[model samples]
Target: MALRPLHPSTTPLFVAIFFLSFGALLFQFVQTRMFSAMLDYHLTFLVVSGALLGVAGGGTAAAVMDVRARRPSSAQLSIAGAVATIVALAIETRIDPVSSGMFVAAGVAYVLGVIPVLCVSWVIVRALREAPEKSGLLYASDLAGAATGGVLGYLSIGTLGGQGLYGVVAGTALLGAAALLVPRPSRVPLRVGLLVVAIATTAVLSIWGETLAPPRPGPFKSDTMGVPHEFARWDPLARIDVARIGDLGDPGHYAFLIGQGYAGPRPPALMMTLDMGAFTPIVMHATDADLAVFDASVLAAPYAVAPRDSVLIVGPGGGIDVLNALRQGVKSVTAVEVNRTEVALMRGPYSEYSGGLYLDPRVHIFEDEARSFVRRSPELYDVLAITVVDSFAALTAGAYALTENYLYTEEAMLDYLGHLTPDGVIAITRWYRDPPAEIARTVGIADGALRRLGNDHPERSIAVLKHGLLGLVLTRNGPFTSLDMQRLRTFADQRGFSIALDPLAPGGQLVDLASAEAPPTDDKPFFFDSVAVSDILAGRAQLPYGYAVLLTTLVLSLTMATVFVLIPVYRGARRAAGNALPPGTVVALALGIGFIAAELVLLQRLTLYLGQPALALSIGLAALLGGAAAGSAVSPRVPLGLRSSAVASAVVLLLVLGGVPLVTSATLAAPLEARVVIAALAALIVGIPLGTIFPRLVAIVGQPALVSWVWAVNGTASVVGATVGTIIALVGGFTLLGLVAVVCYAVAAMFAPQPRT
Candidate 1:
């Protein structure tokens, strides 16, 4: 079987498929963002898993259909998909996830969301089946379209709100339908109608959808904070909302308190929230006397320990930490915040309300990830303050159990220590839970960091204080002097705080570091995952929301794949007597698992290096998919067989796994543009070889009946791989996940089918 060139007459089909692919992927991306705003951050991955399941279902359905009978036109299916997308978006906004419960709401959302994807996939699968000779060109177009969609979707969400972006995706699908009409002059009325509908719908949604069905925070968040926001903005990072809590002139209404113990006259303030949960106050019109309230809190211990001249604040939300530092008479305060939207609000709109806090000449602000900024900075600080950082809902509900948090790792502690003056201290604050898991972990991390820095008795260099539900840990490079200890005791006693850990004082070590859990590292940065899987399985500890949701998704996906895809495909193959399952089937499944597992691992690994999760996702997906497109396009010209391609891909994946840490570390200080380019190149190196394997496997299979089955199996494998890969990463770290991916590709190489001569 020789490769065949695509005919000029198929141009309309090719263009239609491209637009359809673009619209589908863009819709998925926007949906993920919407879910992040509407639900919790950890649940966003469900959208990806849902899309994969839908694709597999569609491919299997197409495979089992009678090829000799008339099927729905590509144009008709495109229109249907567009309509489904809009309806799904509309329905999603009205559902309350909190009241319905996470599991029920997620199931409903997952079902509704997959309908549009299934329609789009059906159209693409039919086109491939109808033109098997053009599989290489068609697949290339598909990958290229998806890559373009991912990059553009990221940019679009920033400019257009989430609702506005949904309209664009629907309009893109309509445009794809219209493209198919180019070869059919008989469908003139259909073409005119589609153009009219596309333009009108896009205009209406872009202009008015925000008022009609704007994305809202979930019931869990909105119940406490109220439904309407004074100011709201959405970006790839997170949704930020500003609420005017009380009148700026009403001093009695705003009793500003610092930490838990401050009880003094304070200025009025506004509340700024992230994802409608983690909140900080924006104090309004405060004089020097009004700022004195900060000195009475447990957070003031670090400032009282020594005469601090300069300070660094990580996550200075609403400028609370900045105000505290200023109150302490610190000479310079540097604040690093990750959310650009939040930064804009502080410096642009709320600058007056904040009394020029962000605009102060003494206060310098950088919009960068905390760890990344610290890694690249050249200045040494007298005190590094990280107090009560992280989302309130996420922490309380254990939603960050599987999420990577680079800030609390031992490596992060080392980085913070390196940038501090010789006698400077690193101050950390976390909510003190029963059994004190977080506090214990914090102590363990500090102890590990000190030992790594060649300090033998870490207890001598560490101090901890507890006030109600809040606990603060202070770690110094050198041992705390007697004066420092006396100052800490005085501050704690004055504020009615208890010393949780101390060096010299008798019975000062309240939370023993000797029995603390193992410290988290950059390789396994799950600081919030205090409960082990074994504990949950043994019924000793309840399952966290994050893990519960992931497990539910996996179970549902597997069930759906088995019922809708695997059964039908198996039956159809059996009915076609001679059309037996080929060796390519195993190769297809392995490719699917290996490709997505490697991709998920790479995204996690790159998140810290790239400075944001959304940026890493966009860059990683686009680069890998774009490289795959190029590889698919050139597979016909390459002389390699399926086995050779699989072997080469396996080699590249292992090489990349070894090189990523080195590359990211060496280029930590590089410009954003340079780092983006380097990350893209790394993805491309692995993707090209991977891209060649699937198309070559398809070519070797030769039977059109088997091609759809192969595609279906690959999609199913991907659906499973997404959840399983995440589980592996959560337990064994990204290194183990990457190794498992290498093993998958190697297995595929052994099962690769020989091409017919």
Candidate 2:
């Protein structure tokens, strides 16, 4: 059978779907950046959850419109989009919730940000409802538009900034509304009104974009420090803010920049914050002198026992560690930092004041994540130094809770060992949250890494301190020698540091190292995880904030499912007893829930491979969306029966999931360009199969009137599934969570509805 061209009446609907999807995705990308600017990158899950729920909300609105027999007016939706643009912009700039009392206001801003997404989604659903026969085509257009948004959003952040992005999204949404009004010439007044609104929004944003969207001092700084921000810059990775305090060219001011979290205050200086909304201060100081390196005291341990020939410093903020590496007379220094703005600030503005640490000929700066740099580098280093990379604010916010941090995992630790010379030492500096608990956690991580590397007597490979701060030193070739031990003791004594666990002594003031389990591993990688529900209830562990939000996501999703998917399907069942409604609805819901569960896990997994959440969003989404669009285009032409198509798709998806670990491991050390190619291929493999299921089901069901109902079921399931996937990963790890997806897909395949054509 030849592909049929869409009816004239449906072409506009298709275009509307495309632009609405484009706008929705663009809006979401903007929202994610805004939230991350205010908070941390870890809250990505929250923004995503909101977008999914907004789609469900839109479907519900469509269901209500269908029941009322009212036509969706494009002009109204465009106006709503315009208003939403203004509201979202205002909320992003104005909301400040640093204190506990203001959390309620922050929550409201988050919810309000989702409204524009809901409006755009509503437009798509209405367009789809207008021509259900073109569902596959419209869905394909939507996915394509989404793919464009992913790529464009990534590009725009580099040039447009947040304000420009807002204007672009608003303009795109207005164009969608205008296109819809093209069919109704008589609605001239409404169209004109929409046009006016669009133009006015653009003008207002263009004129006041700086004041409205400029990066400013966050609530934490304004509420506590009372110092004005010197400069503010935005990037996909983070929002960088610099504040000069106390004096000019003073090293004491340097204390404020890099010495935050240390147990003392020094001369006030320039402070740079990566996450403005951080629960704890994340600052970069100008100098290390008199800056009391309290938490980073462990950073000095490895140097005492090892030669300083070559050093690899991960997350080297404020260039203190780089200076330390150079001061030790290292021949070469490889400094890997994730944030580009921070590096630029150090090299450009603060170079002269801070003695041009980054400008040194020996320093080679790589703007890359720690794990990615470690995995990709083949050079052996004399010292592998990781500063206190853990963010307590991020931990409490649960940004890192659900996501995989290969940096702290067993695999990463072992990989770091691989990059070390014969006498190389791996030094890890960590903040002390609680005494025994943190110690046990850190020891567990280190022990796991050693055991995996076939080091039976892991105790000898470890050097520890029992102060309020801690550091661990591990040797790859062999355990620490007597000379190394003596050196460590001497260094600690000179630095006023206390020793905790020493393999030579066998006993110390610290708890036994054996009790420390290995930190998270690649297979069971969750740095901030719950040991058990009982432990949380018993106050042995604090419940991660991610799980708390997961609960909220579940409740909201189920509520929407009840209202939009379940209620309608039940009513349809009552009205048409022999219509195959039950099987079709079940299949639709299953696919929706199953795909989201898998997609969430895949996104998290890819984040480990890609390093940053922003990169993951850009690359992961592009691959998935582009591949799905290809699959959607091919579905109509495939000759296979519905059941065969379902089974084949599910099988392909399962195979892709099974081979991911192998593929990623092989490309782990490849260059960024090569890694991107591998990621795209992987995405295409999973996406082609995952994308085919929905359209195939739509063909089998063949119920035009029930399109919104099916969409509602699928959207609701996605909302629920995403949250469930995160919880599953938190409890059982990504491997088990993946199996759950495999089961759901297989079940959907087995129970698929056979068309009555």
TM-score (all chains, Cα) for each model: 0.95, 0.89
Q: Write candidate 1's Cα lDDT for 482-566 as tens digits.
A: 9888888888888778788876652323445334457888788888888878888899888988898899889989999988988
Please count the clashing residue pairs in each candidate, in the order shown.
0, 14
Model 2 poorest ten-residue lDDT run: 252-261
Report how far residue 606 has shifted in candidate 1, in Å. 1.3
- Model 1 clash pairs are none
User: What value does the lDDT take at residue 497 in candidate 1?
Assistant: 85
RMSD of each: 2.8, 4.4
Q: What lDDT score belongs to each candidate, Candidate 1 first?
A: 0.79, 0.67
* lDDT of prediction 2: 0.67
